[model samples]
Target: MLNTSEHPWKLVGPWYRPSSLGGYAVTKTALNRFSAPIIQKYADANFANNLVNEPQHSLRFNSEDFVQPFSGDPNQVITPIERAQSHTPLKLYLNTHSRFYVVVCELHCDVAGFPQVERNKVCEAGFVVRRRVPVITPELKGKVETLLQQRSQLQNDLNKVNMQVKTAQLQESQQSSDISGLLKTKSARLFSGLQSGTAEKLTEKLQDTNGQLDQLSQSGDIKIELQGWKSSDLKGVGNWLPIEETPEQITEQVIPMYPLIADPTNPNHSANGKTLWFGVIPTSLADVDSNNNPRFDDADLYEIRCFVRRHHSQFPIQKNHTDCCGDVIWSEATEGYQIAAHFDLDGTSHRPVNIKLPDLPAIRNQVNNAPAGRGASARIIAPAESSLNFATDSMDMPQGGEPLTRAGQQICFFSIFLFFIVAMFLFRLFLPILLFIFNLWFLLKLKFCIPPSFQFDAGLVGSLNFDGSFGADFNASIDAHVELMTEFTADLAVQVAIEGPDLEAKFNQPNFSITVNKGKDNEKTYVDEGVLANDLGLMIANGINASDDMRADIKNGGDSPGLSSLSLNELAGIFIAMQTEYQDVKHPELAGILPTPDSGLVYFEKVELNKEAA
Candidate 1:
């Protein structure tokens, strides 16, 4: 870190960082030489410019000092009055992109031990605006409490209405289904093959059922009857008139009322002695009818009257304003012909103030008595059997006044029981077959979609004799197949096929072997070339019988050929024996170089390093 005491100048905002440094650090001497004097002169010249940017008659203005070397000044005003007279040392902590700061400061060093300083460059300097600390006043606190209470009450009312609607919907659905089923039965009999007299009677019964169903449908409707007090219930606010317009246009035109907080820190910053204006009518009463006649104008006047009835005593009297509450004055000069209130003009005011308006009243008597659950009371009328019948008719008749006989009821019960039994028997017979088909399809997907593996091979092309020595070479092939055995497990089978001139004499192994043993059981199965076909058949058959949970166990009883235990001399002896097995053997005396077991020499296979490498 540079010594901040010596280099007190710090540059902020959108400047280039040549070396990814935090910020530009410049010496105070450099700032004094370049930027300090220019900023101080400008601030002094504009000291009298207030928030309005008006020039003062007292202070002298110098137009030439404001000009910079490169960029022109965009603002004509010298300075705002908000920057009060400064007597202390000039510390120019600026806003973002406010003005340019050009300083001759060392930005980089060369190999020769010399530093570079930027000269008179037009660099834009900007400062950030941060929020002031929160200040709460008593009026704000009271308004917050009132808003919270209103929201809680409205939310409770909404929840009650939602639950009532849901219950009515469920009951309506059940009733509709019952009525429809009774009509369907009557309709079927009316159209079925029967005598004319029977068909006519069924038709009349269906008509009567439909009429009762219509009455039930009307009864189920939710007709909420609200009894709350409207704004019109209040007494003498004003002769308010609502403007005729659509709700959409009215909403766009209306501005919500807001309270202004006076700032005490600056006397000229406050809008103190002014008459605030508001539209005298509420938005609910402003609308145009289909016939183009004005609506709600009379209602809006009554609403303002009610508002004055409640708060007229609190109104302050203004000179010569007596038609209504003197606090609110009718002014046609204001937009929307609004009512106005004169505020105290003292510029030092810095507190929240309250303005009352006409709103819907909250009364428990009106709210509690409103129609709630199941909606308003309704009379459900019974269907008449005939238009001419006036009296001597039972109102609540079962099955349209044609109650079933005892024998008919018994027949209906037996038929329903028989139908249920048949349905159960059919369902039981087909369920197992469907389950078996699903299982088969699942297994087939697993078998056909298993991933396939790739294999590679590398070997010597042919046998070649070394310098004055007999050497033999071999060709080898490596192949692998991957098969998924269980849901999460897989089996990899690898086959190594090697061929040479003297293979049968050394290894004592067949041309091919199906060695199914992995590292675990240490078992190896060797199959001769002639019996390869028969062994493959047995393997496939075993695979078919294996279940999803099956695993292989091919444990060998002995160690791996016992060849690893042999010494180099013993191994040479076995090679000598292999030479005799070959008909035309070369390098017959190569075994003479082999070391004895007492010499403590071993092959690579016996070494720990070779095992780890493998």
Candidate 2:
């Protein structure tokens, strides 16, 4: 009976097709099956690296076109090779016929679009199965829920601590601002009305205020303490727990049959005359009932549907034309081949490059037959179950590639923050030193020079010699007028004129005065001729011309000539003589106050007297 029911083929694995070249080519449909929602944000492409050992194209995830059945007739629809380029067609023919296996199977409509005979061949060779599904246990569910709640509570506590730290920081900033304002105001008042006692009192007040500000500026550090989850906590919580199944229950159930090995007659069968079946059994079915008996009858079985595929290769073959039928000839000049060997004696060795026989099983056997000697201790033990569900998202990514934990992120942030703080602290500590050095350098650039000067009773004059050392040509002159009647009892006047590098001044006294008591009451005044002594005695004692010139002029002008040219040294000598003679005369007294002959000129210049003195 021809059954026209729906095909039962399901896409449980990657779609792979044999290429004209050696390796298999994986399609977008197969690649998308392995993709998870976590990586869906990335562009759709053949992200599966090295799946079939060939480069793949980045194509759109169009399941509509992928699941559609492609017509078997190469003439009606596109060629199989062409259709494979655009989409992975489930139905494929290798351009040859073979009498393959026969079995009752549920074939999906999309798997094949071959003729009735070809479709029947696949159906007769393949089948599907259904198994009992497992369930989760209450104990494991309760443990997971408890852990989730704990995690949530810890996160809330961490947020509260962060808020507290922020609040403390704001309070510190406000306090610092207030203290800064107070300091500025107090400092202005203290300096504006500064006094000896007031300065000390203000300084003490400022120290107290600064101390308070420091206390307020200090803040507490925030610490996050989380109780890490442990694997021991989840030791008894299994992923799934299944119920028991008995022989009575099995007899009542009509279970589907699955074929592990395909017959050699089928075109899809491997070259070695065997088809390897692979399928995943879900954890729900594999889970065991821990409380059940030792026979493990409480456990259930789950079925996972996976499609089968074969790898193909094509190579050119040519028959040897020589007398030897299966002989090959190597030519050093040709590098490739002068002749190829024929595998079949009756048939020609020539074959198309695109046509190849399957050899995957043979290669697998060769790998299994690898020698275990020479320190190679590893061995290939066949797995009891051939199907495995791999985690596709983590296939290319490395371990610890996910986002960091909250604690780890916080530690990283604090480390960077500490680095910035240290940098700012170093800048603050050295900034004043750098500025002081620069200011000192600027002050040194501002040089000043001041010249020497001379001052007098009326006005002041200065000299260009700033070092206070004068050469012999250095000149200083002065003139003075005196009233006639002040120093003498007779009509007398003294006029002085000073000139010369040594500065000799001519002192001329027209007459001197003396008063004598005649008898008891009558007094007579007349000019005394002994010497015009002590004429400059008062001037010498006052240190007006206190230089060697004044002393020389004083000593030289003391006798005989009523008036003569005299210098500061001559005047000093006359004063000494007068002091000795006038020991009985009550007038000028000598205390050695006259300038010593060795003493140099003592000149004082004031800024008001000499404009250039500044």
Q: Best candidate, TM-score-wise?
A: 2
State which candidate has the highest lDDT: 2
Query: CA lDDT of each candidate?
Result: 0.24, 0.25
- Expressed as tens digits, the lDDT of each residue in 305-395 for candidate 1 is 0001011334443324322221221111101111111121110011223433222253335447765532223333333332222233477
Separate clash counts for every candidate: 14, 34
TM-score of each: 0.12, 0.12
Q: State, as a TM-score between 0 and 1, how close model 1 is to the true structure.
A: 0.12
Q: How far is candidate 2 from the true structure (C-alpha RMSD, Å)?
A: 52.1
Instruction: State the displacement of the C-alpha of residue 356, model 2, in Å, after optimal TM-score superposition.
Output: 62
